[model samples]
Target: MKLYKTYEDLPKIKLPKGQEVSISDSTLRDGAQMPGIVLKVDHKVKIYEYLHNIGIEKLETFVYNDRDRNAISMMLDRGYEFPEVTGWARAATSDIDLVLDIGAIEETGILMSVSDVHIFDKMGLPSREAAEEKYLDALQYAVDHGLRTRAHIEDMTRADNTNFVYPMIKKILEIDPKCTIRLCDTIGFGIPFVDVEEPFGIPEMVRHVKEELKAVNIETHCHDDFGLAVANSIAGYWHGANWSNVTFLGIGERAGNAELEKLLLFLERRIEGFDKYDLKSLFEFAKFMEREIGIRIPRNKSIVGNNVFAHESGIHTAGVIKNPFTYEPYPPEVVGGKRAFLIGDSSGIEVLRFKVEDTLHDLLDVKISVEKNDPRLRAIQADIQNLYNNEKRVSCISDEEIQAYVEKYFLFEPIVEKSMGRKTL
Candidate 1:
């Protein structure tokens, strides 16, 4: 009866008592930063509504310009209690002031570049000490203004944990005991393996932050440079971090951040307390991102992709026709997706029969039994095979083509009479 099994000797990821998991979205800020992607105020509002409706806990956005400010204000006007709107700013007094001017956001992410590469090369800072002082000054200003801060330690996976990372965090704790710490995997260099050491081991880093440094709140903001953003974020949570930062469709700078839908689906299945989220809205949200937002979602993308629930192979279609769970990890309706049985070169007779029955029910509101050995079924299968074998057909047969075949093979007096507005058997 077991659907899955794992080794009992492996290190288990049990959440500490009184600790709960939450997802924070950065779609509008980081996701919008993808090259050639521009989200106007209206688009921002619509995306905000989608995230809110899905029960996202927090949403971080930029407030440097009037457009960003107006979007934040419009979203705040709705008065949603779950997704507490937050702001992202560099570790500077001016950036902090911009967030403070927004007035209502109680928390903001203060970016602190920790790695020598960032401090020395990217920022051209004279020394690590100077960088630390600058960040602490900005953090102190935010705390003095009565605003809670999330100290986003940029390039954390590549930073010097002993000299820079730990000492800087200790200093931040001295300023505000309750300040949230966000570990940024800016280059997706973090590894999820438990056996790995610091700098790259995500689990080791999170454990050190939670257990050793005794940080109250920790968030994992990861990128997808190595295609391991979601894995690393989950590792952070499993090792003790509470918040998982994500962007819908994983759209962000370069390869993007952790995908919101993928992470949510994983949490929904593996963890408790996530059932309250409207998981069904994820499909619509993906479509909205693709259509209105002009993002092209790959057909094979996980969770919300069009092909996730589609079956065309003979064996797959037959198994699914008998029992959907045979081929699907979960029901499509769980995420507002539909199971589609596609007819193509790989399709079997069972799929053809099911499509005909389904089409009949749709057209005439009647249920007809279609047996496997029916001559009509064999004839239709022959024609389909001939097209693919002889005519070099490359695409799946559409529903319209299937319906035409059904009409040609089966006597449809009932369909004709029903279309004529008369009751028929």
Candidate 2:
């Protein structure tokens, strides 16, 4: 699809061509940097395998300690070619040596704080020229050691692109023509609109990098402080950047980064050649993150959330019972999620009928044609409504309660046998 259709007259975001978009995960590195989170080697390995199975192209990790090195070694030994294990380091020769000591990683992201805020306030550098020299020297050292480099311009959203950003990237390309430029929207000041100027506009920044600086490979690494990480990342791709740096659940420092599952779903639906990813694995991976890593998935979170496909309101359930498209944006099965008719205070008789049918089919493997106006269905609905109307219930009716009601009112063996020739309910 060239454009995601919303309305014929409304402006649509045009999809960029001539460059295929690829996803690079930072779950093992940046994601682990979230406060109060520590991923052991086993957790890292399992997360790596999960990312590989979900078709991630690359994953960046730290190599500062033996635990990090051992995780890299185990993942590399698996011989998977897609998610090439890469390294992350500060723009220092000592950090470069840490990556080199691993002796297996071929590429590493060299962090260069481009903004004056980071260069001066964070690193306490004397001048922008000194910061540029230090970053360039480190890039040279990495290239000299036969390691492909990704120049991670930290805090690019707040940097001066004309004098500092462009000149430094130009020199980085001069040092290694094949170097990848990763525009880090550190602290998430990036805006997706192209009309906005630099220091805020992600599209303008990406365009300058691709069109002006002539960088061959560009990656967009965004944060979610403004809740625009995915939007800014997509904006970068639409403008020209080919690589999207993401984490599994957008887990990173502060507000986290662009979510891998959210971006994958967007690319799968909006762009071509992204259908190769196993979208079903998204729900499984979210569950794994929640179960193993103790990261709670919000019930209302998009794509893999529990309530994304659930219908509880009376009008919604009624419409969904007729046609699920009336309430759902996409099929629940598309992401390994199931359609649920949750019984609650606002639910209607349609939900009761659906629950009865589903329970019967699942438990007894029998189907009985029941009319929508059947008294048995109404009675079951009344029983549920009574819990709220008279009993002052505050929680949603559970499936076990619905099953009991269905069994009590509708599970007549004679009626079931007469309808479907089944001897059991």
Candidate 3:
């Protein structure tokens, strides 16, 4: 192995850089907003601690609804740590009162529908002026009450940029210049390059808001309506937005928020100095989510999939065996995962030898001769292979069957020949 102090040949980015990228996990808040998804109090604490452990310090637990708010407080009082245990709320004093009742206003976020459709149609408000006044009032109210404020500008993509979007941002910054502003692509309308042109895409929107408002920090809350949530989030980071709201497995309202597992994996690889993210623990935490929360990770999902490191083709397997970096972007060991070889028609003789030698190295006392092309060996191999291939189907085979047929015949065949006292033929 060799080490280098400089990365002279590393790839360079062409886009103008933005702010420091920070992850804000919403596995509890916005994720719970997900239909049919709920975490018990204890489970929420575990997840909260887990996210913090993996270098995600900011956490959003839930909206200001009564049942959920009580649960969040219980978890918070139980000593959940991170940036803070914050609850989400509508941009109304009544909603802020709900957060105060739960003892969370000082550690809360206020979410308002800032887009034209939400302001006009959803809230039945006449115009952006009315919504701006309401938002400013609620933000100032929270601030006056000694609360650290965060505002969600929901559905920024569909909002009327000139009329509703710009003015809303202006008012919020006027109230709290350091207030964390979330540019939500609610309904997932912000695509990276295809649906939107450069310097005006989702990333551009975040950048524009940050610069226009001169807000201390900006956050991105993207949806996957157009399958560009992850791309948009990265672009947001590149363009100076630091914070992002993400959910595990990308689970949320429609398609989902950015998948936390995939999101962290992307950052660990693409962003410099991201080794701070506990890559291995993140995957383990993801597995725990699947086991405890009952949400299974998709097989083709990035980072932690069973097949993410599995190989079967001769060329690929050989390259992986020689050096995992040959075929894999990053070593599986870094993520507490191991590379796997699935032997089938594509396997070459070397792979078979490697597997056989590894398995039989200490168990077998004598060397065994097996031919790659020999018909007899192939038949026995095929027969053995069925046992593995039909593992899912042959559950009906009983212990009695193994004892009466398999153990007796298979184990005794070779010994029987030796004991028969048969001389050389």
Candidate 4:
């Protein structure tokens, strides 16, 4: 079935000269916060190392407890070269103290509410001014402690950028010129579509910060409630923001975050000269997390899902067999995946021919040359159709069943010779 729309159809976007976009994998902090996700200390360490090995620019973890603290410490001791370790915490001195005690992270994200609802309703601050003061004080403390800070603006899309967010960011730059300001769509409300306006307008959002707030690196942290987390992050890049905050498999609060693999895949394609990251290890990392976190990889999940490279329909399978790129955006091998031509009720003779000539021969150690129009191919195809229509099999023919068909036709047995004499159907 057709999806609602695709990013492919959108007009090509090109960023200005000297622009840079990098991705930070947040599988430790945001992804770990998902309900029912409980990572052991070793799980955290493994995840951090995996993200580092895959060339993620940064790793964000929350040292909320002993397990997390120990994990962070261990990951640091390993001395990963690519992903500089980062910590996630509220805009409080206590959180900063904990991060300092963890002793290995180079940076930390200090949560500061920028939206009216978050400042007043969530954090219970009397006014935006008071909220900014409190957050700035904590940020200053972190910078004074020699920690690079990412001023995480919660609900940035819903926040007052002109008066509250922009002005506060200027003050943060004064305290720490190297600090990163992460614009967060905490509730998945941001959508970076064409002709969008403020709140969901990513280009406007980035320009609002860059134009007036002084020089600072920008990161996009979006949720998937609207199912546009990845799109919003890409928009952030197109506009001005450089860093993208993503989680593995898009696992996080409620609808989840932008998928790390999905974001990287797009960056490799859309952004020129951005293919340095080692993408092959990403699939292994996804599988490792799926095993450790006890979450099922949805069959249809983007990039790493089972069905992402599995073909079944007649036209799709035939086209894919001819050239994988015919019916696909890119080869499955691009991300360490294999292509599978799934024979089913809708499979065509072209699919059957490929399966017999390639797959079955390899699987059963049988040599056969079944052309697309071979009479034996038609006979076996009729048998498969009969199995589907008459027997009402819930699934398509199995490898064993296909082998049987091949054996019956080519390596004919004496027992079933009478059935063949009835008529060639």
By lDDT, who's the top model here? Answer: 1
The superposed Cα distance between candidate 2 and the true structure at residue 95, in angstroms, equals 1.1
Q: What is the lDDT of residue 353 in candidate 1?
A: 88
Candidate 2 yields a Cα-based lDDT of 0.88
For every model shown, what is its TM-score relative to the native structure?
Answer: 0.93, 0.92, 0.81, 0.90
What is the C-alpha local distance difference test score of candidate 1?
A: 0.88
| Winner by TM-score | 1
The predictions' CA RMSDs to the true structure, in order, are 5.3, 4.8, 5.4, 5.2
TM-score of 1: 0.93
- Those runs of model 3 whose alpha carbons end farther than 4 Å from true positions after fitting are 1-18, 63-83, 102-105, 194-200, 362-425
* Candidate 2, superposed: residue stretches over 4 Å from native: 1-14, 362-364, 411-425
> Higher-lDDT candidate among 1 and 2?
1
- Note the residue pairs that clash in candidate 1: none
lDDT of 4 at 312: 80
State the lDDT of candidate 3 residue by residue for 233-301, as single tens digits: 877777778787888778788788887777787777666556567767766777887888877787666
Q: Please list the C-alpha lDDT of all candidates, in the order they appear.
A: 0.88, 0.88, 0.70, 0.81
Instruction: Residues 150-257, candidate 1: write the lDDT tens digits.
Output: 999999999998778998999999999998899999999999889788789898898888888999999999999999999998888888888999999999999999
What lDDT is reached at residue 28 by model 1? 90
